[model samples]
Each structure stands twice: as C-alpha cells, then as structure tokens.
Target: MSGDVTLLLQAWRSGDAGARDRLAALVLPELRLLAGRQFRGERAGHTLQPTALVNEAWLRLSGLERIDWQDRAHFVHVAARLMRGILVDHARRRDAAKRDGGQRITLTGLDVPAPEDGLDVMALDAALARLEQLDPDKARVVELRYFGGLGIDETAEALGCSPATVKRHWQAARAWLYDALSPG
Candidate 1:
C-alpha cells in the first residue's frame, strides 16, 4: 500500500466521512475506465452503454462507506464487488421487464465464449454461485479479471500470484463457468 492509501485508510477507520468521499473521488475515474474496458469488445448493437454502466456502478459504489480500504488490492476487490452488484441489478431489472410481458432483455452480446451461444444473466449468476462454492479464490479472480476488466498482470498483483498462475486460473474458471452456465 502507498502512503496516500495508508493515510486514507486511517482516516476512514477514524470515521472521517469526508475521507471516504475523497477515496471515491480518487478511485472513480479508474472505475469508470475499467467499466469501459469491460464493454469494449461488445457487439455494437447492444443496448447498454458503457457510460451508463459505469455511472450505475459509481452510484452503487458510493454507498459503500464501511469498507476497510486496506490497499490497492483491496480497492480492486471491492471495485469488482461493486461491478458485480451493478450487473446483477441490471439483470434483475431485465427479469422484471420480461415478467411484465415486454421485449426479451438480452445480454447475449457479452460474448462469453462458452460452448453455448449466449448467456442470460440468471444463468451467469447461478454459475458464479457454483463457482463460489467450488473455489472462492478462483471465483474472485474471475470477477476481478473479467468483470472488473483487469489484465492478467493486474490480477496477479491483486491476488498475490504470478501472471502465469492468473492466466491458468482465468482459463479454467471461464471454462467451468461456461459449462455451468451453458443452456441444456
């Protein structure tokens, strides 16, 4: 952890609410960038804009003030959590829309390269739940690397592993998730 991060964490721990706001300000730009990268290769016709996703994530993240904010690694982990929450919330809305007999809400454009042609959010969430049960570390790695749009190097740094290890875990986790989430 850098001196600035240590100082901020101390302030946050001391209950200086303003420090939490500063932390959000410092981190929001990077969060926005990561959100953009997460959607970079999406099919152009997909409806959800990257900016909207990031803004939604920002709103959700801003509500988390009780976090320990241990260091950069901790920040990435929390950001991944925030991103997952945003996606899940969006998924829930899509679910509601479908129940109301509106147009089908499709996230199939996310391009998860499972044997399956596309992934509905519900299936994806279920797969993640199974992954969490099987191997929490691998699941977190998947969330941070894929959903958080972090590179292998960044993931390695966050998870305290070698880049090669990060690659292996990513591949295995993706394959497992693909199988688990695959439509029967």
Candidate 2:
C-alpha cells in the first residue's frame, strides 16, 4: 500500500491527473484521521470539521504546481502542515472577531502535561515559528509528531532519521514549546 501511494504520488508529480485523484482517494481517510486529531480539543461549535479540513487541504494540494513529493509520508507531512495553517488562520479570524476569545486546543501525546485551560492555536503557531528559527530539525519533529500526528517511526521515515533521533528531537522540542507557551 505504501508503495502504491508512493507510485501514485510520483505519477501525480509527473502530471497524471488520474493518479492525483486516486492518491486523494487512498489518502483521504488518513488525512481525516489526522485532521480529526487536530480538532479534538477545539470548541464544540467549531466551523471546520475533519472532512472540511481534508477537503481544504486537498484543494490546496491540487493547486500546487511543482512539489517534489517523496512518498506517502512526505505527502502527509505537507498536508498536515497545510491543515495547521488553515487552523491557525481560522483561529486568527475568530480571535479578530471575538477579541481574543478564539478556539483553544489541548496539547496531548507530547509525553508532557498540557495546560489546564488548553493553549491558543495562534500562540502555538508563534512558538513553533520561533522554534523553527532556533532549531529547525526539532521544529520539524514537533510538526511531524504534533501537527502531523505521526508516530516516532513514521516521523523518522519522513525525516530520514533514526527513531532514537526522532525521540530526542521530540523530547527537546516538546520541552522547548512547553516553556515557550507557559505563562511567565
């Protein structure tokens, strides 16, 4: 299945529209799962649902002209990043309309305790941007593990690194993000 996804991705990159459609069909379920995880702690009346998120990502992905997709992991990494952007944009718009009372999301699976009140989506995005400036590799680890909903082995594969390295980066990135997002 992985090989099939990779082949389809390659064909799509080479301008095969049918391959692109097939790839979307093959990957939409996983993308919805990933998007669903992202919305877990969101407000009950949130405007964007998992399927909407997946559709939005697919629309954005379809508009790309020159993405050298590597494989299933690579494609998913991009999709996750796109979904994060969409969430952040939505949160920002909501905040603008509500005076900073936008949707907040709980941080989990970081192996570290999250805040009681949950964290602001924009705040996390800002902290992640700062982390990227300081240590891009670690930031990528967080993006993969947190935003991408990727496990250690999958992250390692996407990053072309060992699981041990992924673990280290994940730990370090989570600690850094925790401190950055914590109120002083």
Candidate 3:
C-alpha cells in the first residue's frame, strides 16, 4: 500500500491525471477517517456535518496536482492545510447567508463560541497569514498540530525538529495566534 501510494504521488506530481485519481482513491479513506477525529465534538443536529467537511477537504486535496507530492508526512500536512481552508471557506459562506454576520462553531450539546471580537473566517485566515509571515515554522507547527492531529513527536519528525522544540513552538504559536486573533 505504501509503495502504491508513493507511486501514485510520484505520477500525479509528474502530471499524470490518472495517477491523481488513483492517488485520491488510495488516500482519501484514511484522510476521511483522520478528519472525523477533529469533529467528534460537533453537535448532533448541526448543519455543518462531518461528511461535508471531509468531502470538501478531499475536493481541495484532489486539486493539488501541481505540487511535488512527497511521502506520508507531507501528504498529511497538505491535507491539513486544505481541510482548514475548507472550514474557513464554509464559515465565510455561512456568514454570508446568515441574518447575523459572524463566525462560530457549534459543538455538541449546543455551545456556540463566537470568534473573538466578531472575527470572521477571513480575519482568522488573515491572522494565520500574518503568523505565517512572522514565523512560518510556528504557523506550520500550529497547522500540523491542530489541523493535522499530529502529536509533538510526529510534528517534530515532519518538521525536521526536535520534539521539545516542537512543543515549545506549538505553545508559543498557539498563544501568539490566540492573541493575534483576539479582539483588542
């Protein structure tokens, strides 16, 4: 399975359309399963269903045919990024269609936490962008840790850093992001 996935990735990166489809077929089930873990706290009757989230993520991933698709960790990181984009885009669309314009996530049993200071998806994305500019590694630590569901060890391995460094960077990045996203 690993060899096949590697071949699919190589072929897809080499501009083979069939390889892209094969790559999607080979990787999407695991991707969906991983994505499911991130939303287990979602409320029962929430309109933002897990399937929609997974499908959106897959669609975005399937479109990344131009990159040099590397091994497992790289795949996971790109998937994480695409998934975050899907959620942010969905939030933006929901806000556009709603009577009250803002961003929020509805967790299980009905606790909807609004973004700090009416910060919508765009604001969050912009904050992430700024974070990326100031410290790309820290921003990526946040993405891999939170969105990719990677542990510190795994993130450190993916990032070619030590576990202790990953942990420190993760903590610092989260604090920075929270402050950056928070309303003054």
For each candidate, what TM-score against the reference? 0.78, 0.93, 0.77
lDDT-better candidate, 1 vs 3: 3
lDDT of each: 0.68, 0.84, 0.72
TM-score of 3: 0.77
Candidate 2, TM-score vs. the true structure? 0.93
For residues 70-175, write the lDDT of model 2, one tens digit per residue: 9988887888789889888988888998996676776777543445556787888898999999999999898888888999999999999999999999888988
Tens-digit lDDT string for candidate 1 (1-184): 2456557766877788787678767766777787777666454554566678777776765566676666767667876777766666776776687673211223332335543223455566667888999998788888887676678898888888899998888888877876675556
Worst 10 residues of 3 by lDDT: 106-115
Where is the poorest 10-residue window by lDDT in model 2?
A: 109-118
Task: Compare the candidates by TM-score and give the number of the best one.
Answer: 2
Candidate 1, poorest ten consecutive residues by summed lDDT: 101-110
Which candidate, 2 or 3, has the higher lDDT? 2
Task: Give the lDDT ranking, best first.
Answer: 2, 3, 1
Q: What shift in Å separates residue 155 of candidate 3 from its native position after superposition?
A: 1.4
Ranking by TM-score: 2, 1, 3
- Model 1 — TM-score against the truth? 0.78
